[model samples]
Target: MCMPMTGARRSTSFLLALTTAAGASLLTGCGVLPGITGGSREPLTVMTWAPDGTQATNMPGMPATAVAFSRWVNDNGGIDGHRLKVLTCNEQNTNIGAGNCARRAVKEGAVAVVGSYSQFGSAFMPPLEAAGIPFIGGYGISGEEFTSTDSYPVNGGQAALLAGNGRQLARDCERVALVRPDTIDGDDLPPLINSGLTEGSRHEVADIRAADDAGDYSSVAAQALERAGAGPGVPARIGRSAARQQARKGCVTAVLGERTETFLDSFRRVETADQKVRISSVVGSVGQALIDSTGGKEGPFEGAYVTGWYPESGDPRWDAMRRVVDKYAFGDNRIDTDDAGVQTTWIAYTVLKQAVESLDKDSVSTRELAGRLDHGQPVTTGGLTPALRWDFASMLASADFPRVVNRSVTYQVVRQGRLVAQRKGFVNVGPTLENARTSG
Candidate 1:
């Protein structure tokens, strides 16, 4: 997904020192604002961090999705009659790289910037905030991060939601062993998950740890097993003998790290068919790969209860997503819309596009963009995910966008290396935004 900047785009070195203050002043002094015609060609520039980074999947789905949306925009006469040009740069999760990228976008005069697949949006928040350029695709945990007053989270706040998955499992278990990855992927998740538990409902949390630096599943599995317990045929024991029995009784469960592939690798290294332990994970951990390899027929995870953020299997939204796939995804019909990353990316981009269209073209400044976003706006993306209503105050309070887009968590049962939705369709886990705090 790493796209090289076209020859028309500026180089990063010269871009870094470019100041938006001078650019704004230059626009004002030249009378560019008042004399600008509604019909003038102004390319809407987007700076995304998908291509180069620790989390880069090169899924071909994200960039493909962007291409489809851009094609649609162009076919419909473009944004406010100006041709929309996407200037993508791979920030590679470096502050210097991201800062340089933002400067280059501003230097090239991008009205809005879009990014995701990592924390680049948060890292670049200050610059974009100062430049007054709309920064979309940021999902930060800190209220201050979301309070940028210029940026808007296209995919909603993630820090709280990521943590909420662990909190939600507390009721079902008395003890949990948290085993996360030793990379940037699992950075913000552990702190939020541990702190969100209520006093009375708190469970015995095992040591929070990262997977081995070697990315070796055996060591990770060994460490997790040692924490749980060591017994005959019981690999990476994550529960005491009593806790193990209690796990069957719904008193303890294992909460693995964030990534789907990593979790599966560890599970495979330590799991046996006879091992009867209830495991829990977040939506981002849901993927066809896991469902096929571990959660499939004769796979290790036959009865895992996976918590998903969006409804995927048999979801009505997939009908619309199919339209998007047909129109944009490319030659392969096998694109996994069910993949959590793919779904989240799809919704994130759609929300950003809708936010862009909702703003008053005359005031395309980032502050106005953020303001328009904070208030309720109509988002019609024809996406596979439910419509998003970005309640900015709620978003501001919880380090998450406080809005409910249907309270359903798609749970699937693994059968024959495939996930088959249980007899229950999409299960409504109740409104996710009830705890959202907002100060009027």
Candidate 2:
């Protein structure tokens, strides 16, 4: 009810307001500031990053799944009533884009980067490492995920998938061809698949490298068919049916992430009934969802072999996650429950929640979370993964991928358009990897 005296009072008032607002902003950008902190009786913040809407490989489902998990947890009392704040970034599948996302996570005060995807580990790992931020449940796309001290991978990453695929293929195929990306990460794949092949006394894989983002893989498909089907060591072709061909003709397995479908399309076009070879891929590159979209029983993937880090999407272990998605992330089309990325994100978040819950407090530091996980904490993911424990003693005996703890992979095959288990339960490929490391 007092009248302004004009200039001096108004100017002073404005300056004071500006000062207060600036202070608030400073707090907002901190990794843990005031109410929104990794402290007791407070909210926790984390990030999930992945490439989306890119020309090359993309996993829109990973970040989308993280968003869904945040929505679900926050709605359901939020990890012991401390709300979960998830910040998602699109890495755009570039080195700079990955670095930028990591920097953003650091600036925005994320306690951890959880259940994310990026093949460019060399780009993103540095920022998080410098900030001492933990990376939990990454999609395991890069070698750095296995080597970096900050990374706590939920699965054996591509190493397990390829090695498992090798073991799976070796059991049946007369010859093996691996079509992988020509990137640095792709270089590591051949040795892994070979390790599994060695276990079954099969010959080394015919390593074929291709562009990850190619629009046309017809030539590559032709090459794969020739190398795998007519490679030097293969027996003279005598079979026609897929089942018969796999054991006599050969097997061609591609691990080209999102571009796998394109490769298969090319493979299908060049392939005739008499020239058919057994098709195969790891779970992240292929799943039931892809099988359905391609033509089910009549598709190229109808008789393909696929190796996975977890049970197939239809397993009852995923019921709880499905329930959460149906309740909170309803109609979010980006989330395909069958997607390996979506499943990884769900499990990664589950690990994070369990680590946080173990603290039994609202406040958590990056050290606290990492410490709890590193110190032999066993997280049960409702059977989504073999109860994961990342203690040093539990890790595998490989110098290349020493941090690997859960080295189990499921061997699956497409039957009647569905990716069902080829063999019952999880297959332990630790010895295969260990052998590969020794031979390398």
Candidate 3:
């Protein structure tokens, strides 16, 4: 007793089938919803925010990477069968904007805020702390991230980099000069850099401050070169003549964030063949993309010294992260695997995943997740970062950064326009930090 097949009925049936498949894909692709078959009753919600489309210091990739991580993990049955949701916000590089993002997380019942970036930690950290939510793996831009009890930083913040950079430059350059932004946050940079320089028995760094966002850095560049003991009139090597006595090898390190490139451009223009001063910066200021853009082997960054939290972009340890980006975030230009923000986001999510998986319950609350992290669960980042655990003993003894658990940095140098490993492995800057704490 089958009805005769009609063209109209066939079209309707096909449409219904397509709709069903689309619904299933949406549920399983990025996140499974509560009450969906095989989904846990309690869903996990998290937020990731960064300045986007702002005048200065934007990190849109941090949030974008969060989205991609959600999609990839959900596709593979989600994190421990619990539905995972990511809420992203734009901080707009303002205090009010950062506060707004933090308030939104509180309103939305986010269990955690992971891998975010903001210089206004004063505005943001309060809300997360009040709500008893943990902040994990922030981009290390704000000082409150280190002092807040609820924060679990994966890497030592900017303090570690300046110190590490000083240490790296100390080996070869007898005189080192630092050019950094002129801002409230920038005030702390000089002391940290000096700590490392003095640790290596080198003279303290000459602090040179400049506008954070300037169209020209000619004056600044000239001043830096002059102070670093690099000049066109002096010979590259020490000579017997009194005039050549000023030829002491020098280096200038800049930490102007995005404007580092602009400063370097001006520095190159002012540079003379007789000047053998080396250029230096930390990872966030210089990376593979910048080097490639400047023309590989012929780039201005060639022979420049760089320090970073992770390995060089070409290292084999990053193979697993590369595969994830390829499988999930392919062609998504916002999520650059080489980007430090994106890499931090990936590692932050890995910690969250491990935290959730460790609990044996079908439903989880923010307190439960935070408690798991608080009890010192070791998180493995596939060798991206050192094994991370946050116990009382693990906290750094430093006054400003007591919550920092990982104080290691890698030394890298630009060779033929590519960032290569300058040191074999992570350089332990813990002693320098402790020394700085005691001395300061």
Q: Residue 231 in candidate 1 has what lDDT? A: 31
C-alpha lDDT score of every prediction, in listed order = 0.50, 0.83, 0.81
User: How big is the RMSD of model 1?
Assistant: 11.4
Model 1 is weakest, by summed lDDT over 10 consecutive residues, at 249-258
Candidate 3, residues 1-440, lDDT tens digits: the string is: 22333598856754664479774454455444433444545668999999988656678888988988888877776778767899999999899999999999999999999999998999999999899989989999888988898898888889889889878877777788899989888888888888888866457788899988787899999889887988456543543232323443688899998788888889878877666577789977877888888776666667888989988888888887788888887678887788888888888998998888889678877788778887846888888889998888888878887877889999998875788999888998887776664222
Q: Scored by Cα lDDT, where does model 3 land?
A: 0.81
* TM-scores of the models, in the order given: 0.69, 0.87, 0.87
**Per-prediction RMSD in angstroms?**
11.4, 8.0, 7.1
- On the 0 to 100 scale, the lDDT of residue 34 in model 1 is 35
Weakest lDDT window of 10 consecutive positions for candidate 2: 31-40
Tens digits of lDDT, candidate 1, 1-440: 22334453535422532456664454345433332343344556565544433442333344455556565666566655545566666665566766777788778777666544444444566676677787654433224335465655443344434345545555554455556544453454455445433322455445445542334455555555444443333334543233333443221123332344665576666755344355555554555566575536555555544555555455676666657767765655435666554565566566666665666364355566666666756565464434545564333333343333334444444444555564344443333333433331
TM-score of 1: 0.69
Which prediction has the highest lDDT against the true structure?
A: 2
Runs in model 2 with CA error above 4 Å?
1-40, 230-248, 437-440
lDDT of 1: 0.50
Identify the superior model by lDDT, candidate 2 or candidate 3.
2
Clashing pairs in 2: 31-109, 38-364, 39-363, 40-363
